[model samples]
Target: MNPIQQFVRWEAEKPEAIFLQQPLAGVWKKWTYRQAGQEIRSMATALAERGLPPRSRVGILSKNCAHWIMADLAIWMAGHISVPLYPTFTGNTIAQILEHSETKILFVGKLDTWEDQKAGIPTGVACIGFSTYLKTPFPAWEDLVTTHPPLKEFASWTADELATLKYTSGTTGNPKGVMLNFGAFQFVMKEGLNAIDVKPGDNNRLFSYLPLSHVAERSLVEMTALYSASTIYFSESLETFGANLAEAQPTIFLAVPRIWAKFREKILEAMPQPKLDKLLKIPLVNLLVKRAIKKKLGLAKCKWVISGAAPVAPELLRWFQKLDIIIRDTYGMTENLAFSHINLNKVKIGTVGHVWPGIQWRLSEQGELQMKHPGLMMGYYKDEALTNTVLTNDGYLKTGDKGEVDREGFFTITGRIKDQFKTDKGKFVDPTPIEMQLLQNPDIDQACVVGMGIPQPIALINLSAAGKSKSKDAIRDSIAQTLEHVNPSLESYEKLEAAVIMQRDWTVENGMLTPSMKLKRNELEKANLEKYPVWYKMKTAVVWE
Candidate 1:
C-alpha cells in the first residue's frame, strides 16, 4: 500500500497512539494517528481545490518538521507527485529543480534560513507558508486547513502510478530527478519493514534528524512510522540534537559516518581516550563505561544501529564494541528508492552486506555492481540518455560502483566507476580501497585520495575534532605509522606520498559534501587543488594543508 493508505490504516487501528512528536518553541508538540490523518486530509483537500491535475509535481522545501510530513502525505492523497527539495540547497539549485520539474506550488516549511533560499523560487511559482520562519506575503498554512474540509474521496494509486520525483544530491554533476512509482516506494517500505522486523503497534521509536528530502530518512523515519505505527521524535535544532536524541532513546538509530565520528570525538573529549581505555580494561567497570557511553549518546535502547551514505571505518565499529554496539552497514541509491542491501544478522564491518531479497544482482566485466530492481525507477525524469547509461537494457540497473562478491553472497564496494586515477608513472589506481585503510585511523574523520597528474597519490585527510587538539607531532606520527602499514597491501600506484591534513571541514554549505552526506570528490579537489602544491613542497609525511 502507499504511505497515505498506510497512514489511514494506522489511524483506524490505533487512533490515540502517538504518531509524531515535533519539538517547537522550546516545547514538545504532538500528533496522534487520528490527528495526523486529519491534518493530512485537510491539506490534501486544500491542494485538490487548487485545481492541480492528477500527477502534478509539487515541491516541499524545509528541514525535518511535522508540516513537511503532512504536506508530503497530502500531496500523495491529492493525486500529485511529492518532490522533496533539500533545505540546504542553494537558491540556484532550488530554481533549477522547480522549473525543470514543472512544479508551481511550493510548500515552504520549518526552515531556519529561508531568507537565503527564498530567492530561488521563480516568479511564476507560488508559495504556501507552513513554518514560523516563513514570514512573507503568502497564504498561511492554517488558512488552507481551516477553509477546506477533508476531500470526500482519496485518490487510489496503481502499481505503475508516479508517486514522487527524488532529486539526487549532485555529487558529480547536476542533480537528476529520480522518478519513482508507487510500486517501487511501497516495495521499499514493505521490504524495509520486514528487514527491521517492524510490525503494527510495535513501539519502535525513531529519531528524525536526517533531511526528509533523502529517501533513507523518508523511509526509515516517515514511511516506516506509517507502515509499522512507529512513533517518531523530531530533533529541534543542531544545538538541541543531543537532548532530543536522549529524550527519544530510539530503538533503531541510523547515522551517517560523520555524525558517528563526531559522537565518538565528543565522548572522548569529555572522557579522555587514555582514561576510557584504562576504564574499559577493568572487568566490572567496563559495564558502567558502556552504559554511560550509551546513555550519553541516547543509544541505550538502540536494538539496531546502522551507518550508511559512506563507508564506515572498521576502527570506529570496533571502538563501539567496547561499548557493546554493533553498527550494521547498508547500501542503496536514490534511483532504486534507496532499497537494496541491508546488513542484518551477519554484520560485516568494512563490507556492505548481502543483496536485498527480490533484487537480482550481478557484476559487469568491469566489476561495476549491477542489480535488477524489482520496482526500479522508470528512468531519470527528462534525462533518458543519463538513465540509459546507468540502467541496462535487460532490466538490470548499473550501480556505477565497482565491487566483487565474496565466497558468500555479501558484496564489498571497492570504488566508484569514475573514481580511478592515473599517476604520472602511467599506472591507474582506485583509491577507495587505500582510503578505507587510512580511514581506519581513529584520528582521521575523512580521507580522500587524489593525485591525477602528480607523481604519487596524495591523501587529503580531515582530522577528527579530537585529532585537531593533539600536537602536530602526535597526529603526524599516527598517520605516518598508518601509511607505512597500509602501503604494503596497496599497489605502487596506489601508495600515498603524503597526507595533507585539511584545516577546514568539508561541509554541505561549502559544496564539498552533499546533503545526503556523500563527499563531492570533484568539488573538494577543485576547492583544495591549489593546496596540493603547498603540501608537496613540505618534505614531511603529514603536513597541515
Candidate 2:
C-alpha cells in the first residue's frame, strides 16, 4: 500500500480529468491528471539524480498553488521527506526551520512580500523556483520535466517510512517539526475522505486559500484531491478571494473561524436586525432569505464546510445553520496531520466532537488530553529530549490541551494547560471558556482573559463594529449588561473584576498572536499588566490608546 500509487492509479484510470486549476495570465489554467502525474514523475527522477537521499529533507516555500502540491508528491515519490513552510513566515522563522530540519533542497514559491526570505536560505542548499511560467533565473519547477525523463515508476515507500515534516507554529516556544510517516498520512487522508463523503470525479472543488503548510487544509483538503481526482482552485491572494469563490463555486469549503466570522459580519451588516427579524417572521420569505445568503457567499454548492485550528463561537455556528449551511467544527493538531476526529454525523455546536476511528484518547489525571494513534508523529525532528517528554512510555502522545469528555464520549477543549493561570487568590482560572463566552456577546470582536497575581481575572477586549461606532454611553451600557449576563455562570474567582476595550486588533506580526491564530497570552498579560488597576476599578468603559 504505497501512497504515491493513488496518483498513479488515478492518472491511469482518468488521464484527462482536471486535477488542478491555477491562475495564469489573469485566467484559470487547468492541469489534467495525466499531465500532473507525468510532471511529478519527471521531477522525482530529477530529485533522485540530484542526490536527495531517502528521507532527505526538502522544503517548500510558496502560497497555495498546483506546483506546491506537485512538489510535495514529487518529493514523497522520490523517497524524500517534505518540509512545508508557511507563506506568512518571516525570514528568521524560515531560516530557523531550515536549520533545524537540515533541509537539503528548497522549492521557492511565489511570494510578494516574504520573498526576501530566500536570502536566508543557507548557501549550500540547492534552490528551484516553483512557477507556472518558468520566469525565474534559478531552475524552474517546470523545467525539471525537460531536465530529466519520466521514470517508469516512482520510488516505493513502506508504511513505516517518513513522508513529511510539518513545523507547526508554536504557542509557547519555537516551532518543532512533527514527523508524519507514510502510514499515518495515508490513514488520516483515507479516514477524512470517508468522513466527508468524497467520491471519484464528484465535482469536488476546493478553494485553496489557506496556507498549505497547515494540516487542516493540507490533509483534509489537498490530500482528498489525490483520491477523488478533484479539481483544486488556488486563490491568488486575499484581495481576489471573493472573486475566486464566485468563480469556483466549490463543492467543499474549509476556513478558519476568523474568515467565517468575516463572512457572517458582511451578511448581517447588509441586513440590519429590524429588517432581518421581520424577514424571519415570514415563512417562505425566511427560507428565501437564507438561501439568498448562502448563494451570495458562494457556499450554496458546498456539501460540507469545516472550521478548525481555533474555537468558533456557538452563536456564529447557529447563525450559519439558519442560512442552511451546516458548519462542522473539527479538532486536530499538526502532530496528527490534522485528522483526529470530526463532527460529521453528530453535530455538537460547541464541542469539538467524538474521536474518529483508529485513534484512542484519554484525559490525564491533571486533565490534559493524551492520545496514541497510528497517525501520531514519529517524534519531533532533532529534539529527542522534548519528544521523549511528550511521548509517554506506553507511546500515547500528550497533547498540551486540557479537555473533558462527556458521558457520550464527545471531547470539549477547555484551554491549554500552559495558558491556565492561578489568580492572586490562588484559584485557577482557564481563560479559553471565559473568552469564548465574551466573544458571544456580539459587541466584542476579540477577548483575552488574564490576571496572574490579581484578585480576579481581567478581560481585555477589542470592540466590535457596533461597539466602536456607537456612543460611549451606549457601548458601556451594553458591555456592562453583557458582563452581568456572563458573570453568573462563572465561579466567584473566575468572574472578571473589570474589562478594558482596546483600540487596535491583535495580529500575528505585532507579537500578539502565534501563527496558528492563538493568543500569545504571556505577551498580552505582561504588556497590559501595568494597566490592570485602571481597568480593574472601572465603573465605566474605558478605551485604550
Candidate 3:
C-alpha cells in the first residue's frame, strides 16, 4: 500500500468529507478531502514548474497546521524527499539541518516567528510561503493553488523509493537525518492499522500539537490519517489547547509524558487528592465521577490515547487507568518509523508492550535492544560512518537503549546506554529508574540523577508550580521525606545521597530537555555537576539550589 496514494483514494471515495481543520482568527477553517487533494496536487505542480527534479530534497519548517501535512504530501507527490524541521529550532540548527540534507527548496508554513526560520534559508534555496508571515517575493500558497491547475497525475514511488529524511531529536548527540523509504512507512502504517481497528463510522478525530518532526507524532497524526481517514485538527497555541481539545473531542489523542504529567497535575488541582479518592470509592458516584473527569479533561470521546517519545512513570499510567482512561506506552526511534512495540489490550504497566508480530527484536550482550525490522530506515543522510555505527552488518539496528524483555514479550527501557554513569566506587548506575521514582512526587516536576566520579549519586529536582509556591521549608521537607522513602529500597551504589531542590524549570529554552521532552543528561550534567560537592558538604538530606 502506498501511503501517499491513500490521499488520492480517499479524495475520490469521500470527496466531501472534512479532511482538515485549522483555527484562523478565532474561528476554525475547514477543508474537504477533495479540496485538500486539489491543493496538494497544485503545490506539487508548482514545485515541478520551478524546475525541481525528482529526488530533490525540500525542507518544511513549520508548526502543526493543515498546510504542513499538505506540504508533506505534495513533496512526496512531486517525487522529492521532505525534510521536516522543528519549529523551535534555532537559526543555526535550522541552517545545519537544511544544509546537511542538501535541501533545494523549502515550504514555509504556519509558525509564530519567521525571522529566524527565514534567516536559515540558504541563499539561492527557494522558499514558498503557506502563511501570511512568509510573504512578498516568493509565491504564496493561495495564489499557487488558485492559479495552477491540479496535476492530474503525481509521480508514483516504488516501495523502495525514499519518501522522507527524518531528523532525530538528538538527546545524545547531534541530529542525524534518517533516510526512510516508502516501504518503511508502508510496513509500519499497514502493520499498525492491522493491529488497531479504526472502527468504521466512528467519525474519529485526531488532535495534533506535538512537533510533527518527531517520528511518534508523524506516525500517529499524519500516517494514521492516511490509513484511517481521520479528520485532523491542529492546536492553535498552548493557551487554547484545552478549548481546542474540547471542541474536537478527539477520538485519538497522542502526547508525550510531559503533557500527560501536566494533565494529571491539572486534574489534581481541580479535585484535590483526598476529595478525588473519596468520590471514587462511592458505588454509583464512581461511574459519574469517571465520566465527569473525562469530560473535564476533554477526553470524553477518546478511544485511543498513546504516550510515547520517552518512558513514562508506571505510577502515571496507573493513575490514568483508574479513571478508565487507557494510555498505551510505545517504543521506537527515528531509525525505524516509531511503531516497533506498542502496549495494546494485554498491557504490562511498566513495559512498552509486545513487539509487532512481523518485526524482529533482541537484547544484546550488554542488554541494549537491537531491531531487525522492515520499518528500519535506509541510513543516515551523507554519513555512512554514523549509520554503520548504529546499523549492524547483519541488518540489526542498535537501539542504544538498555532494556530487558520479559518472557511474555513486554519490553522495558531502563535507560540509555550512554546515560549509565560509573561512580568513583567503580559501580555503574542507571539514573532513569531512580529519576522516574522521584517524579512520582507531586512536588517534583523534573528530576535528574547524576554521579560521575562522585561517592554517591545525587538528584537534582525541579519543583512544580505548587511546590514553588510553597514555603522553602515545606519544599525541603517534602523532598527529604520522599528521599527517605526511596533511599532504603535501592542498593548503596544506585541510591541518591543528597538532593538539590532547583528553583529553575527544566525546559527546552534552557537546554535541559530536548524538543521531544526527553532529558538531556549531558547538558544537565554540564550545567549542574559542579554544585554536587557543595550540596553533599551541607550534610543535609536535601539542599536548595
Candidate 4:
C-alpha cells in the first residue's frame, strides 16, 4: 500500500494514538491520528475550494513540523502535486523554484529566516501560514481549517501518478526538480522498511529535524513513520535541539556526517577523549560510561542510527563503535530516493555497504557509478534535455559519483567525477579522498582540496570549535601531524603541498554548504581559487589564511 493509504488505515485503526509531537517554547504539543486526519482533511477541502486546476503544483516552505506533513497530505488528498522547498534556501532560490514549478499556492510554516525568504513568494501565487510560525499578510492555516469542513472523500491516485516534486539541494548549480511518483514511494517504502526490519507500531519513535525536502529524511523519517505507524517528534529550535532530542529518545535516528562530527565535539567538550578512553578500558565502568554517553546524546534507545547524505569518515565511525554506538553508513542520491546501498548488521568500516535489494549497479569506463531501480525518478521537471544526460536510454541513472565494489558486494564512493581537478603539473587530482583524510584530524571541521592550475594540491580547512579554542601553535601541530600521517598513503601527484586554515567557517548561511551540510565544492573553489598559487608556495607545511 502507498503511504497515503497506510496513513488512512492507521487513522482509522488508532484514532486516539499520538502520531506527531511538536515542541513550542519548552513544552510539546501533540496531535493524535484522528486530530491530524481532521486537519489534513479540512485543509484538503479548503484547497479544493480555491478553484485550482487538477494536479496543480503546491509548494511547502518550512522546516520539519507537524503542519508540513499535514500540508503535504492535504495537497495529495486534494489531487495536487506537492513541491517541497528546503527551509534554508535563499530568496533567489525559493523564487526560482516556485516560478519554475508554476506552484499555484504555497504553505509557509516554521522558518528561522522567514523575513528574508518571504519576498521570494511570487505575487500571483497565494500563501497560507501555519498559526504557530510567522504572521504573514496571507491567510492562516487555522482560519482555513476552522472555516472548511473535513473532506469526507479523499482523492485516490494510481501507482503511476506523480506525487511530489523534490528539488535537489543544488550544490553545483540551479536545483532541479525531481519528479517522484506514487509507485516510486511504494517501492522504496516497502523494500526499505523490510531491509531495515522496521515493524509497524505506535511505540516506534522517530525524530524529524533534517530538511524533509531531502530524499534521505523524506523517505527514511517521514515515509517510514507513515508506513510503520510510528510516532514522530519534531525539534523545537536550534537552541533546544539537544534537550528535544534527549526528551524524544527516538528508536530510529538519521543525521548527516557534519552533524555526527558536531555530536562528537559536544561529547569531547564534556569529557576529554583521553579520559573517555581510559574509562572505557575498565570492565564494569565502560558499560556505565557508554550508557551515560548514549543517554546524553539521546541515542540510548536508537535501534538504527544511520549516517548519510555524504560519506562519513571511517575514523568517526570507529570512534563511535568504541562506545557501542554503531552508526550505519548509507549511500544514495536524490534521483533514487536514497535507495542505493546501506550497511545492515555487518558493516565494513570504510565502505557504504552491500547493494540494496532490487538495485542493479555497474561502473562506467571513467569509474562513474550507474544504477537502475524501480524507485528511480520519472525525470527532472521542465528539463527533459538535462534529464536525458543523467538518465540513460537503458534506464540506468548516471550517478555522477565514482565508486568501487568489493568482493562481498560492499560499495565505496571514491569521489565525484565532476570534482576532479587538473593541476599545473598535468595530473588530475581527486579531492574527496584527501579531504576525507584531512577530516580525520579533530581540529578540522570542513576541508576542501583544490589545486586547479597550481603545481600541487593544497587543502583549505575550517577549524572546529575545539580547534578554534586551542592555541594556534597547538592547532598547527595537530594538523601537521594529520598531514604527516595521511601524506605517506597518497601517490606523489596527489600529495598535499600545504594545509591552509580558512579564516571563516563554511556554513549554510554563507552558501558554502548545501542545506544537507555537504560542501558546495564549486562555490568553495570560486571563493578561494585565487589564493591557491600563493598558499601552495608557502614554506610552512600548514599555512594560516
Off by over 4 Å in 1: 530-534
TM-score for each prediction? 0.97, 0.95, 0.97, 0.99
List per-prediction Cα lDDT, in the order shown.
Answer: 0.85, 0.82, 0.85, 0.92
Best candidate per TM-score, number?
4
lDDT tens digits, residues 352-391, model 1? 8987767888889999988886568889999899889888
Cα lDDT over the full model 3 = 0.85
- Candidate 1 achieves a global lDDT of 0.85
What TM-score does structure 4 among the candidates reach?
0.99
Worst 10 residues of 3 by lDDT: 130-139
The better-scoring model by TM-score among 3 and 4 is 4
**Candidate 4's C-alpha lDDT?**
0.92
- Backbone clashes for every candidate come to 0, 0, 0, 0
RMSD of each candidate relative to the true structure: 1.5, 2.1, 1.6, 1.0
Q: Flag regions of model 4 displaced more than 4 Å.
A: none
Question: Could you tell me the lDDT of residue 209 within candidate 1?
Answer: 90
Model 4 Cα lDDT, one tens digit per residue, 428-449: 9999988888888878888999
Any runs in candidate 3 off by more than 4 Å, and if so which? 132-137, 199-201
